[model samples]
Target: MNSLVLVLVAIVFFIVAYSTYGSWLCKKWGIDPKRPTPAHTRTDGVDYVPAKAPVLLGHHFSSIAGAGPIVGPIAAAVFGWLPVMLWIIIGSIFFGGVHDMGALFASIRHDGKSIGEVIHVNMGDTGKKLFSWFAWLSLLLVIAAFTSICAATFVKVPSAATSSLLFILLAIIFGFLVYRRGAGLGISSVIGVALLFFCIWLGLEFPLHLSYNTWVVILLAYIAVASVTPVWILLQPRDYLNSFLLYAMLLGGVLGVLIKHPKIQLPAVTSFNLGNYKLLFPILFVTVACGAISGFHSLVGSGTTSKQLDNEKDVKVIGYGSMLIEGVLATLAIITAAYIGQDKLAELLKGSATNVFSNGLGEFMTGFGLPFATGKSFVALAISAFALTSLDTATRLGRFIFQEMFDKRKSADEVSSNPLTNKYVATIITVVLGGLLTFKGWRTIWPVFGSANQLLAALALLSLAVFLKRQGKEYRMASIPTVFMFLVTLFALVLLIIGKMSNFGKNWPIILIAVVLFVLAIILMITGVKALSDNKVSEDKNFKA
Candidate 1:
């Protein structure tokens, strides 16, 4: 099979799905453009400022796109391209798109509060508290793991470090120009993107070198400030400009595939077992993680994206559209592994999934007149940039969840004067804890991130379904996806617990955390189901699912 053909087919599938299925979802859920979004209703210039569709899309996409799609798909290629590709395509269109869009819609309807608050309204305070703890902890793992990952990347390729810093400064300038000085997004974006590429080039000329530990400290400090700062000044604009890097990389990868027309060299199906005790079913789904669906996307959607949404009409495009784009990126990622064949993939995996993707993508770009070394470096820098984006965004989200936990069902703008609810204090607390875990080693924290992350998706789906049911909206779309994710994550967590029990002494903390998450999921599931069962909605309209 030609890789280019696969790319073309996936693109068509996404476009059609977005136009038809995605649109149908919005209509069924009753998206009203006339209804003021939370951003407009609660404009604070901090987290609740209304954003143009393009800028919000960029921020939302950048926050969620991170290394997950690239790393997860490439790593899961162990199950072979057939299963990985199948899951990415099918899962994204139905599971991920609906989950992402639904979470965003649910949050906006609740005045842009998180899924936790949605749970509060529908399922009760107990479910809300549990979900908040679970979500905040999961995001802590995200901050820890991505912090370490980004730091290691900086230490390995100092040029990425230089460019990443330059990117931040560039975002600040762009934000000020567009927001403060009334510069138009069009002209500013053109200049901003031009400067973005310049940062990459300059990074190559003057690479910044720092120790791994030093880079870790610097990154922790960066996120501490970045997460607490207003959205427009840094987070939103940085993400907006950084999105162009991703767009460029995607364009390069797609054009390169077209020009090279590489054959899919890997076998369509490796054995289901892969010679490990891990079965193909749950492990494959878990390993693919964000490539197919992720719980973390719900956090990004409801946590940040919903707050900045300008209009209800943009929900489908920003929420569902971004997920489909991620699906395509995941498809392209798996294609990188497939094009390289199993032997090379195994070798590259020995280093990192990032290596496999960069090397493979670099080779692809050579067909388009790019030097392999430069192209490889460019790909590496782009990955690091995105990983950094996810890092700070996770930190900010952790802050939101933490503050919300103390707010007692209040909307985002109505936090009390409790010391714990202070944004700066919350951000510092989140970053400090994450930094401690980073020092402990991302390798230790990462083992359970997948299960915890997917579990989050299950919980978010549960919350969304319950919210929709309580509101007399069509929720069957969330039903199967909800049940499926719950099954997958629970299965994965159980397997993880049993496996970790072998090394009980060293792995007790992980076991304990997993057990807590497992119990939380069970409790939340029961609560959500009970809430739905108790609802008085007509059986004909809402009970069929």
Candidate 2:
């Protein structure tokens, strides 16, 4: 077997081990699935009720598994596959997994409030405010990124864009039927997958021609509605459908590599050079988040997900398992593109890696009884649909974090607490901002998000480390990985900032944005020092049902 096949096999084994062992640990922790979640316990029932396990996982995965995982790994593959591969495995196992699991466990134990709430309660008001800024900014970057990626893909592939529109409509129809209509998950999932494939077929048979502006309008409208809808309605159903697409892409991508048997073969390691922008450890870390550790995981873990825990024991699966799936996805992407030839990858996938991914997957799926044209088109549209779904979720999450950041400056009525209102305003603001900024033809803006995201990763990891420290028994055991990842991420982000600053110079729109973030990152890091010495803290609950 080639290196790609071996790497894939190893990833599969690790995922199984982690999920199974993590589940076992949950039972060992005495987590109970029977008790009401904090959302339900604290709910007036309009919203904030605890979710079913699958539903919660769907929300979490959809929110966190955005273009980051797809884009980060692919872009960082420039640093050669070894470092990316190493980080993906080690980070998921020790760093990212731990960060995600820790945030989740902490939030659940505290109540289904956000990480911001937990920060205030345990780390103090100052810590909460600073971390909240990091959280909101991190999510905003997500909105800009995934939105741009989707917009670009829609513009490039009109047929796929139309297919995506159909699939999303189908997702909503089934979402309402299965979730809102009390139809079973199994039935809904099956039907949802079927509809997606049919849309793919339809796209091939009769391509729709949507202009770039027209598609953007459609994308924005879909996001506005989907963001506020209940998890069961749009988020869960669509994500469930998207998950199958992702899996098919994964399977097909792997098969393509196997059939092609190409290799990166670009030498075991490449030198760290980006001209005068020396890419030391910092650049490596910041530019390569999802493959390694991402701060964004904390938001999702603490956001809608913690409310839906079937049992405290399931964190490993939802948190760690979802990340593992992403890692596998990234690895497959690496093999597919690298094996195909890097120059061709840069040519074909340039600015539209999702298209190349879907294209490759389409070719692979064609052998599985799917028509060639239909499969290729299906592959493109499936990714676009997923990206659009993530754009909506990320916007809502950003809005939630933004509004929740500061102390109440006004009465509750004065504040916009309605998710619908918040989502609409947030999406418009971000899309408008993103559209305006990139309209100047900027690739620099793209990496600003990467830097900001890595900084967020540092903050979330620090919080996770703090949580572990407070757990007396677990503290000692967790300290090593916590400290190691903390330092590595910190170093990586610093490099990202330096690179951005150097790359953009004084007129650097994105560099200025990133520098501000780096300062905030430092302040938050200082806040951690205070958290360490300030022994007076809230009661950290046992995360059992």
Candidate 3:
């Protein structure tokens, strides 16, 4: 298979999906351009300020497009490129896009509330409380895993570490210029991009050398500040700036594929079992978690993006459209892995997916007339940017979860009103806990993180199904995906539990965490099922009336 053909096919499929099915979903969901979003109505300057569609899209895409999309496809490529590509295309259109759009719609309808609050509206208080804690823990796992991953990158690759630090500084300056000085977007963006490239050059020349442990502490400290700062101050602008680098890499890779027309050297289908591992049904589903459907996107949709949404009509674009873009990135990742060859991929697979992606992406960039070392450094910086965006976003979302959990019994006006459970307190607690979890190592946290992420997506889909049912709208769109993800993720959890129990003494901590996640998932599923049943009964009664 020619990589160019794969790239073209994926691009056409995504465009068709976005134009037809995405538009259909928007219409069916009744998107109203005239509707005032929370950003307009709530306008708190802190969390609910309206943003232009492009800017919000940048933040939303960058935050959600973390290493997961890159890593999942690369890791799951062992099942062969065909399986990975098929899942990315079909799943993005049907599952991931719908899940993300529904989440955003639910949150906006509820005045920028987190999905946990959405659960409360549809599934009752008990369900809300359970889901809230589940979401918080899932976010903590995200923060921990991403922080460790970024820290490791910084420790191992001094250029990436230096570039990332400079990126943060540049974000703050960019934010100040744009938000405070009222600078023009075009001018500020050009300057920001120029400075970023300079930093990349500087980082290569003067790299930062830090131990892994030190890097972890510094990264967590950065998260602490970034998560608590006003969205416009750091989070939004930083993501917007980082997004340029991401887009460049995506475009560069696509063009590289087109120019080089690399032959796909990897097999199209391998054994369902790889060594001691099985690449069959549920494992492939879980292994390819993010590229197809990620629960974390829901967190981002409801937790942060909803608050900044300027128009109801933009939800389809930001939520559904961004997901399709990720699907494309995932496809590119599959191509990168395939081009790396099975032998080298097997070796790289032993380490972080960042290694595989950077190396392969370096080769791709070389086709564009760049030195492999420089291209590798650039790719490494982009990966670091991706991880950092996800890190702070997860932290911010975790804060929202904590505040909601603490404020459960209160009225909407009083929620998070108490200083004790305020944003600052909640953020600090969330970051500290996540920092502790980071010490457990990314290798230890990733499996559970991936499973928990997919499980959360299942739960979010169920919440959306119930929301649609209450609206007297067609809900099979959400419900069917909900059921599928639920089963797949539940099966994955069971397998993890069995594996963990078998190594109980050596992995007791992880085993305990896995058990808790399993229990929570089972409870949440039961709650969702009951909610659907109750909604049906109510609809029947109303029909009789």
> Tens-digit lDDT track for model 1 on 1-545?
89998899889999999999999998889988888888988889999989999999999999999998988888788888999999999999999999999999988888888899888878889999999999998898888889888887888788999999999999999999999999999999999999999999999999999999999999999999998899999999999999988988899998999999899999898878864357787888878888878888999998899999998899999999999999989988999999989888888877678778888889999998999999988998999999999999999999999988887534535647789988889998999988887875655666588889988999999888887787788889998899999998899889889888988998887798899999989999999899877765433231212
Where does candidate 1 clash, by residue pair? 295-457
Q: Write the per-residue lDDT of candidate 2 for residues 262-368, one digit (tens) a residue.
A: 54554335666755454636555655676556777777778767765657556777877777776776676555445555677677656566666666566555555
Task: List candidate 2 segments past 4 Å from native.
Answer: 1-4, 16-35, 43-49, 211-214, 258-260, 278-280, 349-351, 362-375, 406-442, 476-507, 540-545
TM-score, each model?
A: 0.96, 0.87, 0.96
Give one digit per residue, the lDDT tens place, for model 3 in 80-128: 8998899899999999999999999889988898999888877889999
Q: Rate the local accuracy (lDDT) of all candidates.
A: 0.89, 0.64, 0.87
Q: Please list all clashing residue pairs in model 3, or write none if there are none.
A: none
Q: What local lDDT score does residue 224 receive in model 1, on the 0 to 100 scale?
A: 94
Candidate 3 to truth, TM: 0.96
TM-score of 1: 0.96
